[model samples]
Target: MRYSASHKLETREKLLQSSAVSAKRSGFSTVGVDGLMKAIGLSGGAFYSHFSSKDELFASVVESELRQSLERLGAEQDRDKLERCLKQYLSMCHVEHPETGCALPALGAEIARSDIAIRQQAEHWICQLQESWAQVLESDSLAWAILSQCIGALVVARMLATTELQHKVLKSSYDEIGRQIAGPGA
Candidate 1:
C-alpha cells in the first residue's frame, strides 16, 4: 500500500532526527546508511526513498542539527548576560552529550573535507551563529573569537581520555572567554 504524503513527510522527519543523533554520536563518515535506517525502525532500502546517498543524508543531518543548535544559542543570548549564554555553549552537559549538542565540535573536522556544498551549508550556519553573537556583543571580532574558542575547547575536551583533563580544558576556555567578554571597560 502506498503511504500518504503526510506519512511520508513524518517518516522523513523521523529519519532526519535519528540520523542527526547517529551522526553526532559517531562522525558522519562513520555512520552507515543501513544502520541508520535500521535504528529508526525502517529497512535499509527505505533510506534510498528519502535520500539519494549517505552524502545526501549527511547534508540533511548537518543542516537540521546546525539549525537546531543555532536556535538554542540564539535563545540563550541576553545582551546584558552574554557570558551566561556562552557558558551554556561550554557547559558540561553539552560536553557530555555530543548527540544533542552543537555540531561544530562533533563534526567540524569532517565537514572541512566534505564536498563544497556541505562546506557551504556549514559555513552559512556558522555565520548565522556568529552574527547572533555579534548582535549581542556588538563586536564582530570578539563574537568570532568566542565562538571559535568554544568549538575548539569542546573538541579538545572531547578528545582527551581523562575527565580531569577535559574539565580543565573547558574551565580554562570558559574563564578566558568570560574575561574577554567582560573586559576592563565593562
Candidate 2:
C-alpha cells in the first residue's frame, strides 16, 4: 500500500525520534534499521524509502536530540537560574534515564567517532550550548568551565560502578562547582 507524502514524512520522523531514544539508551552504532523500524511499527524495508542510508538517519537523529536538549535547558541566558538548571541536569535522574536526558553526556563518545556530517552537527550544537552558557556567566572562562564540568561530571557519574557511587560523584561535583561559582561572598 502506498502512503501519502505527509504520512511518509511523519513515519520517517517517528523513526528518527525512536532511533534517537534508542541511541541515547544504548549507542548509535548499535541501533539497527530493522529494530528502529519495528519500534515504530513499520516494516524494515521502508527504512530506505525515508532515509538514503543509516548515516542520514543518524544525522537527523542527532539534530533532533540536540534541539530537544536545548529546549530542556530552557532559558540559558539567566545567570541566577543557570546553576539550578545545571544541578537538575546532572542529577541521578538524568544519569539513570539516558533516553530522556541530554545527548552530550549520554552519547558524546559515539558522536565523536561518527561520520563528518554527524561530527559537524555535534560541534555546532556544542557551540550553541556554549554560547548560551557564556551569556549567563561572568566571563567566557567560567562559561567554558561550567559547560565542561557539567558534561564531564555527567559522563563520569554514568560510568560509575554503583548507584551510590554515581550519586556521590554527582553530589560532590555539583556541590563543589556550585560553591566555586557562588563564591564566599555570594
Candidate 3:
C-alpha cells in the first residue's frame, strides 16, 4: 500500500530519531539498518525510500541530535543561570544516559571517523554551539575553552572504570571548571 507523503516523512523522522538514540547508545558504525528500522516499526527495505543509504540516514541523525543538544542549551540562555545549566550537563546523570544525552560525548569518536557529510554536519553543530556559548560568555575564547572542557570532561567521565570513578571524574572536573568560570579573573 502506498502511504501519503506526509506519512512517509513522519516515518522517516521517527526512524532518524530512533536511530539517533540507538547510535548514541551503540556507536553509529555498529548499528545496523535492520535494527534501526525494527526499532521504529518499519521494515529494513523501507529505509531506502527515506534515505539514499545508511550514511544519509546517519547524517540526518547527527543533525537531529545536534539540534536537540542546541535546544537544550538554548533553554538556558539567561546568562545568570548558565552555570547551573552547565552543572547539569556535566553531572553523572548526563554521563549515565548516553542514548538520551549529548551527541558529542556519546559519539564524538565515531563522528570523527565518518565520511565528509557526517563530519560536516558535526562541524556545523560545533560551530553553532560555540557561537551560542560565545554570546553568553564574557569572551569568545573563554566560551570555546569552557565548551571544550565540558565535552572532554563528560567523555572522560563516561569512560571511567566504575560508577564511583565516573562520579569523581565528573565532580572534580565540574568543580575545577566551575571555579574557573566563576573566578573574578574570568
List TM-scores for all candidates, in order.
0.94, 0.92, 0.92
lDDT of 2 by residue, 1-186 (tens): 888999988888899889988999999888788999999998899899999998898888889888777776644458667877878887999998989889888788888888888899888877777777777665677767878888899999888879999998899888877876786776
**Candidate 1: where are CA atoms >4 Å away?**
none
> Cα deviation in Å at residue 2, candidate 3?
0.9
lDDT of 1: 0.85
| Strongest candidate by lDDT | 1
What TM-score does structure 1 among the candidates reach?
A: 0.94
Q: Residues 40-134, candidate 3, lDDT per residue (tens digit)?
A: 88788988999998988878888888888888875447665777778898888898888888898888888888988789988888888778877
Query: What C-alpha lDDT values do all the predictions have?
Result: 0.85, 0.83, 0.83
- Which residue runs does candidate 2 get wrong by more than 4 Å? 74-76, 183-186
Q: Give the lowest summed-lDDT range of ten residues in model 1.
A: 74-83
